[model samples]
Target: MSHTANKDALAQGTHHLIIDGIEQYYHVMGEGPVCIVHSGGPGVRWDYLRMPLIEAFLKLIYLEPIGTGASGRLADPRGYTLARYTRHVDALIDHLAVGTVYFLGHSHGGFVGLRYALDHLQRLSGLILYDTSPTTGPEFGQSIEEALQRFAARHSIRPEVPKLLAAVRRVFAAEAQAAATDEDATRELQQIFPVYFADYWGREREFAPLRESVWAWSDPLRGQEPEPYDVRGELGRIAARTLVLAGQEDAICVPSWAQVLHAGLPVSQLVVLPHSGHFGHLEEPHAFASAVRNFVS
Candidate 1:
């Protein structure tokens, strides 16, 4: 299927950037305070966050990370790291001629946004982290299990734990073992949405139709990570005021990571939205938008 474009998006138009003979894409909307919103996936596009109320809170500048959406792919491919993504945003800010801006990076986008803020604190007014963790490791351990256990409080673990866990692990191993490890494998991970949402079983169908617009071939980056893969050490360097948003039920970027981020940053606030999953912006739009508006105000 062709990627869906929001042609009727209120007051919005597609934009582009060309560097190193590679063209990149980003969408701009609204006329409020400037806020750049980066979507999840080191490989996925920003198609999922185009809600109406988001525009009401702030001017939304949706950046299409290189190799995804309508953007050009890097020739080296190794340049697909979070640091490269940070540079993409850097160029956008200069190209657009913006003074100070607010950045809202969701999931992997949050990883990029965090890196960008730490390096260019002077140009940022605030940082908004949603459904993202500072680093990767045990901190992101089987979030599906964590999400389930959250629902069954007094219990140490969910009764269906063994089978559910084995199944999730099998999928991960299968993807890793595949003959080809590409962004399309990241696309296949979408089929396992049950592990991503608060109530995947109940809302499985509602989640199916919504698919990734573009799946860039960048999983090679997911595999070449440092041992601990933890960025807690650098969180203190994020001088920009920060807002950490977590879905109390999000298994992907669990709320515990949010707490860690809150504790690390010199100045930050944590808000765990109730009954939300990784996609809290979509699951609870009004509340998410309000939190963003208040924080940036």
Candidate 2:
């Protein structure tokens, strides 16, 4: 669809539902077959995926689970367990009166979506997994720790928040100054680029909200112990048509996990995008949207 057409098609709505005494926030847009898009982090804001996927699906439902985004934070970390997350999704579906929906999940959201398929098979029309795994092993956890350590080391050289904010301001200021010199560059750099970058950077800033909310719900579980969440056994029981999409460059979830998920689902198809990473939808929007549209259709 054209940009204007898509913009005109968008409709926004919100609903508050309580699950286990914790209020969760959910947003609905467009109108058609229901498709619920889950965020990557157990705590990531749903807004991160809103523009790309919501525009494509049009009739999409973006859910911010309890203790995430606009949702109320939970005091107990025990309530943030996988089982409880699954129950929250069920409650949202019940509240929406949606008998069945196409469940689209990314990263951590993919794990929650997998659990939903296992526990409530009858409620799903189809399943779309983007860079997610059914179960995470010890090696996976170790790899993540290593990556985070590397990231910390890289950012440690900088002066922290002020430095980062200064950099953003400098770039935007440069663009604005350039726009003052030439009308074309003004429109391209100042008007276009700044708006895009601001929106993108704003989403990154929202990660703090995500982390804090999840911490609120999961703090009590910290330093306690790690428990196994095995969804491998239940994979074969999933009856919904499944679409597994993976990015070739995704280091975290890895492409192999998508292959494993495809192998496990009784009726499923797998598509691996080239030159793409964990955020395949953002990295390759046309291909990602086309793959999902074709599979779900």
Candidate 3:
């Protein structure tokens, strides 16, 4: 099919493309410059990353990364890696026939976006590193442990705090993840959903529906985990303008990480949402949308 025809089909609704002998799924919304969004979890459904406000100014293509949602799962679950994810993004951009589009990656998706920007710089007009870091493993793990302690301390009096902490712990437990069904993962995600927001309990009326609806899938890693990621030295190489976004109270991807990204990237800006945690897009939609629009425009 022609490039124009391909773009038209993408904007209409859900679409799939055969990439690397597997089905790759994506959805499109809005009507301007193409901005491909990659969601977090490495296994979370893409629905959570939908940016209606940003969509108002830029055509948003939400990618269902390989091994997530209805996208094809790997023959060897260990086969899911940043390299493979980057390749898929490259393929999707090529398939779209939209030259030099914007790229936004959240959480684990941000990891993929970083690698993609480094490896495929020419294809991106801009990069949005939303609630992500340049490295993971020991440093990232330590940060999470510390953040959780703070989160626990902050809500110590709340009866549900202990339960939420336990659920978060189980969610990260290797065995639990390996054995988790969609229902199990989704339940755990819902249980610990409050930690992802700065004030989930305070704003329960507004956020309850999303908290109840969010879902996740465990990464199918049968002892083949990706190598510890660190790209601080390589940040200088990426010339594409970047927007490093973080939430003030984000327990996982902390603000320090965003600071590192902002400091390292040669041409980049950082925006910290005061009233948000990990999910700033949902926590502060208008602010998130404005930052994105101004940067892209």
Best by TM-score: 3
TM accuracy, model 2: 0.69
lDDT of 1: 0.72
Candidate 1, 116-193: lDDT as tens digits: 888899889899998888876654665545655564452235465455545556554424543155654555555444
Per-candidate TM-score against the hidden true structure: 0.82, 0.69, 0.93
Tell me the tens digit of each residue's lDDT in model 2 across 1-297: 111222322346776667777888778776667788888645444765764554555478788766566787666544566777778888767766656778888887898889899888888899999888877666555544453343334445444534443433443341333222223322232222211121223355643333233221222122111467667778999978999998775645667788889999999999998756566676577888899888867
Q: What's the lDDT for candidate 3? A: 0.85
Q: Ranking by TM-score, best first?
A: 3, 1, 2
List, residue by residue over 136-193, the lDDT tens digit for candidate 3: 7577767877888889888788898888888776666534546357677677678788
The pairs that clash in candidate 1 are none
Name model 2 segments beyond 4 Å from true. 1-11, 51-54, 142-226
lDDT of 2: 0.64
- Sort the predicted structures by lDDT, highest score first: 3, 1, 2
